[model samples]
Target chain A: MSSGKIVELRQVLAERFPREIPPPASLLTTGIECLDRSLEGGMRRGTITQLVAPYPSCGSASLLHDLIDSMHTSASQFVALIDGKNSFEPLGNTDLLLWIRCENANQAVRATDLIIRDGNIILSILDLKQNEVQELRKVPLTAWYRLQRVAADSGTTLLLITSHYISGSCFAAVQINNPLRINDLAELSYTVSQTRLLDFIYRKNYAELGYAQA
Target chain B: MPKPSLFAVIYTPYYRLQCAQQKRLRTESNQQADLPFADRQTELSDQYSQSYSSNSNSITHQTIPPVTVYIREDIASALLEDSQIIEINPTAEAAGVKIGITPSLAVARAPELQLYAPEVELERQQQQALLQLCYRYSPFIESTGPGVCTLDLRGRRNKNQEIWARDLLSRWRSLGFAANVGIGPNAELAAQAAKFANPYLEVVENSQLLRSLPLESLQPSAYLLEILHNWGIRTLGALIQLPREDIGQRLGLEGLSLWDRAAGRSAKVLHHLQPPEIFKETIDLEQRLETLEPLLFILRRSLEHLVLRVESVYRLVAEIKLQLHLDSGDKLERSLPIPAPTQDITILFRVLSQYLETVQTAAPVVGFTLEVFASDPAKHQFDLFYSRLKDPNRFFQTLARLAALVGNNRAGIPERLASYKPDNIRLRLPAFDWKSNSSISAESDQPRIGPALRRYRPPIPATVELADGKPICIHSNLIKGHIDKQRGPWRTSGNWWDPDGWEIQEWDIQVTDRGIYRLTFSAGNWAISGVYD
Candidate 1:
């Protein structure tokens, strides 16, 4: 209907075409290969995972750094890092650090106090190494429940990177350990060799396997 | 021993050119304007073999010419709702078309340049705001123009400035802007370097690339630029090979700047946003009510908002414009002087209301707009002295109410001749003169005003029916009589020509029991001035 220009345009277009598919989207990869495999294609935006780091320098900061670098829009973002010991250093760029706030520290309250706070995403890192976490006999059970509700209500992923603690009040206690296996090899030398084991497990799910670590 | 050469410490300031100035720059002609250039060069050559200075042997000049984003008319629709695209079309030439043409062509086709002009300005503003974030990285960032900004990622920034630059590019892109940054020894190169869609980073060390770039990238006007392109002399290298004389013969004076630009040199520097001379916002209400409550309330909120906005930028208010629009659509703009910024809403409220009352409210007020102009060069230092009585904000609130009742004009400081000689030179007027730069110098360092001086307006003749010098009044105006033990003709005179410029010098006369009394002679009449310690 649009005339000869259409016919000329059609004749001009009967050639090659660029691919319609877009370049592959880049995802922030967790260096732990086994964990990455469990995550399928790695942590997508909606996926939430618990970060239970038992020690410092155990790649907790490394993971966050990679995530922030990959996202690259944290400057305008509202990031909440509840550093119990005030150790969550927002690295990368000073320009990026301008928008993050570290609240819920040196507090005067129950965990319920933190539950009411506002933020786009909340990262509450409790220092299991601190005396406060170790001696929490006075903390009310309601406080712990409120903390969980805070993360759930806000839809914020709460990464609890902490040291290992021996809590006596155990009800079917279970531990998920890093896959590294350290075995005694005195015959060889003082230096030891180990294989890193990476897998997920739930004792309750494995009734037959019982308490075997995956 | 050989002396080592030190890199030049360049200090460039961005001068905020007024809108009129920018317009003037756009219209300035180049070829005809080159008469001065030819004459200057001729004179220089006569004095010294000009080639010595003109030698292009070592091209030290860097071009950081600013690139304003230009969207072709067709590209407009594509960017209409895109916030990432800062719309700054100065000319609506391409009002019909909407998006997708090359960046260079978008610039070429734009006639009115509304899209490019305004976009660049807006981009510059956003960039400056970005600079607020960038300030954490380095204070060396200088704004050359809208979108045409320069930063000296010098010192420690040398290590991460590239990464920072890359990150910034991504940030801008995410924000929906096609931002390109070029960094060189100066701003000119950085700007020209920003034209590419990809990360365009250039250093003076990368000067070799400048030669290969087109003369269109230099300072050529769009028309002449198109001609050069059609001629196939696309690159700077192609243009430079032409005898310098021929290029000059054709392009004229712009040829000189072009030569400098081609050498990657920019004479244009960053322009700083000096605190605005006047920042104002006026609101027109739906209807007019005579009561001072709402007017005062509005004034309070507006003052708070203005203070908050300017405080982050600069401090103090030099002048205030209170424009009241009557229901009949008549606007009365009352400009007033503010000695300094008064955070106290009450003070402003009172002042504005009083000014409002001065308005013969022939019709109900439909709306009012308040604008404050301020500039504090940091010269006026304050000395430790007596504190101001009412908080500025509180004072405004009070004044706002008074203005609403009496009129804003009447609510201001009444003229009292403080000087013995009331000449234009020595007339002691209100600290805040509505027509002057009322900002106080150096915050404060003055002998405190006496308690008597707190509230003093000149005088009305009082009948001295000599009693114990206490006080007395008859109602025509407040009248008080006291024994005149100390006497002196405190003569105040001003305005040799104008009838309004009168100087009434007052004497601090003390009676044996009345303590200190202020007596002034105005219109050849003596009135009780004020009390003093």
Candidate 2:
């Protein structure tokens, strides 16, 4: 195809699909240089982001701890951690954290719904990393979509931490593959800050690229 | 010079009788009086007579129109004191029953007579209700006497005081009280206006209007009235016309005081009052409250009224005490603590409705008393960047809904229990002033490492092959494989003094297929207790 015809086709596609360009100031900083730069500042507000770590010791929990600590220290915002299967253990300042420990994935999802509807906390993390696959499977697809809607309405950043990709409604998804062995707490935290995750290509990127071509 | 302060006095005539009628309406409609409903007037009269005769000792039959009603009916009636007729109704007056006459003699003169003793408690409650109602109009109010309230309208500028007075009187009349309102430059003048003014309101610039009022309106001692009658001073105008120095010399302080009052020069210092802080209202439901909607409606109305009153005093409602009087004669009282002291009607209503929706009354609601406790508005210094909940009341309401949906103990902040047992924690409701602070530093002294374990509530039962007290393999629904790496059993037990004591042997093992699992052997059963994240 000729370049002019390609450009015309791109223009038509761009007109059909639009992508949200959040204000630079509205994005919440993760306090990690590479992560923030890759996501163009940090997580988008009023959207859900998923961190998928299929293997053990993939640094997802460390990332959660870092994000919570950063939010507490920098933004002075409250963080709610809905721990599915009652797994999450606090590693840093818990004064700003409201930990809701649930018995199963169902309970955690319900807790997330309540917290998002309350619209109180700035960040809500639903940690389902240790939930059994059978228990997690019990959650309906509509529950995740409902959570996304509530997150948008409440203007809260919902970060879903799980062992595998569970929903297609996430605004952004990143897979943790970096592996590191550490003997001390300091080394573990440093490794966590240094580890890089692969971000899955979102549909928004394709729309943006189409718009740029047009 | 400061302008003379204006005052308005609300005087409810026959306050005790009105209170007795109110009590009868409140307590007797559903219980006693078999009068036909179609005859509403006679039904009300019968209810009043029945209640009045039951509470009073002077009357034995439920046929007489209580003393005040007899007076209104133009029938002979007298109020007895110490076996003498202290006051005679107008009908009795026309029938030759005079004050200070023996009751038997007064009865002889007026062959058909009715008498009623005073109800002190009922009168006191009615007075309080009057004070509470008038306090809404003006903050500086005083319960001058039984059924009398003096309101200071100093800074209030209604174009016509008569219209304001009439509106007040109408409100009192709606409550089944015959009230008269009068406005003047001073309290004494306002009271005098209420007594003798033709239209119930008399705003006098001088003592000119006081001329026609009888000396009896002043309510002087009988000796003073007798003395005034003998002196041919029957009117306030005539009394004021007398020389003040001569009256003081002749009649002493009593005569001088009366002279000053009639002349509108009385310097009586009014006890400026602070309206009582109590904000409560009770109403008998016309129909049974079988559902939550009607009860909520009434509660919202009462809450709005109380919120307005609390706002008038620059305060906020901190708590609500709801008392439901059920048809079963049982009282259900619930005290709802406000998450945040607020004047918002919607928030207060939500708090009340949330409670009422869950409350299971023993019987149909017949009456209710709602009392809201007031507090000074809470002052919060919010953080510069961190925001608390945008609306705390809304958050609390959502919390309540969530608690209702899930069990109450299931949803809230998790607090770890101080025990050696694994997975020990409890949920707690958030405080009102929950806010985030960036200055809070982490407890870095004890930094934990390794992935947190996810506990399986009621661990899955498993079959394990043992070799020298070590698990060689495990078979379970979630994990079915040979154990690759294994740890020895760790034993823990607690509560030996109680029959519900527990002893458990736990082991950390990695299955070939399942990544890692915590196996527990308790009561001769091996189960997969949890999984390592």
Residue-level lDDT of model 2, residues B256-347, one tens digit each, is 99888888877767786766778887776767878877677656655655664565354678999999999999999999999878766666
Native contacts recovered, each model: 0.00, 0.30
Candidate 1's C-alpha runs over 4 A off are A1-214, B1-183, B194-202, B205-214, B219-233, B236-260, B265-313, B324-329, B336-370, B375-390, B399-533
- Model 1 residue B379 CA deviation (Å) reads 11
* Candidate closest to the true structure, highest lDDT: 2
DockQ for every prediction shown: 0.01, 0.19
Q: List the TM-score for candidate 2's chain B.
A: 0.67
Candidate 1 lDDT tens digits, A40-118 = 5443221123444343223333344334333323222212233343233333231221111122232412321332233
Candidate 2 chain B weakest lDDT stretch, 10 residues: B62-71
